[model samples]
Target: MKPVRFQFKLKYLAILALAALLLGNRGFRSLVRNYREYSRLKSEKAQLEQQRVDLEKKLAEISKKPAIEQAARTELGLIRPDETEYRFPAPKESDK
Candidate 1:
């Protein structure tokens, strides 16, 4: 009877230890989740960095004298040295 009681106590202790072991590693799942998130953010950072580089190159080109003059002349309707500038008033709601 004593041997049976000792065996029962051992089994209970083993079960308790197993439960503790499982509970002690609760952060493992979160660690894996955070690692995945970190990788995704790193990839996004790289893509954005590349886009920034591309935009900087484009900005450099646009800042050149010829490109600036062309853009101003075409998009903003700027006049050259010999051209006459014209001003037109916006139509009001009453005119419509």
Candidate 2:
């Protein structure tokens, strides 16, 4: 009778230990997932910072008067003072 009672207690303790181990394992997996997401967001933030710096440098360059004038002339086809301006009339549509 004594040996049977001891065996029952041992089996109960083993079951409790297994449940605790499984809970701990699940907690460890969740921690790993959170850490990976944190690292990915940090790297993306660094990339965005680099892009911002590059844009700021370009903005500084384009703030110059000469650069602004050159861009306007090339993009808008604008002319300086003393330059001749040509205007072409729109062609009329022919009767169908």
Candidate 3:
């Protein structure tokens, strides 16, 4: 009977160790996943910051008088009162 009792305790200890190992493995996997997500978000933040700077520069340029007039002349097709507009026909593709 004493031998049987020792065998039972040993089995229980083995099961406990296995359970601890499985739980630790799961926790380690979660840590690795979180670290990858953190790195991805950090890089995305840098890309967004660069885009924001580029947009700010564009905004500053568009706010200027020359840029506004250029947009009006090209996009809106407006010309000065003293200026005459000319339209040229496209050359034939065969000419190229």
The Cα RMSD in angstroms, rounded to one decimal, for candidate 1 relative to the true structure is: 6.4
Global fold similarity of model 1 (TM-score): 0.57
**lDDT for residue 68 in candidate 3, whole number 0-100:** 99
Question: Each model's C-alpha lDDT?
Answer: 0.92, 0.91, 0.95
Per-residue CA lDDT of model 1 for 8-76, tens digit only, reads 999999999988876677687678789999999999999999999999999999999999999998899
* Residue-wise C-alpha lDDT for candidate 2, range 1-96, written one tens digit per residue: 579989999999999898887777878778889999999999999999999999999999999999999998889999989999888877768732
Candidates ranked, most accurate by lDDT first: 3, 1, 2
> Clashes in model 1: which pairs?
none
If both were scored by lDDT, which would come out higher, candidate 1 or candidate 3? 3
What is the per-residue lDDT of model 3 for residues 3-96, given as tens digits with 9 covering 90 to 100? Answer: 9989999999999999888777978779889999999999999999999999999999999999999999999999999999999989999988
List the candidates ranked by TM-score, beginning with the highest.
3, 1, 2
* Error at 31, model 3, angstroms: 0.6
Better of 1 and 3 by TM-score: 3
Q: Highest lDDT, which number?
A: 3
Task: Give residue 51's error in model 3 in angstroms.
Answer: 0.2
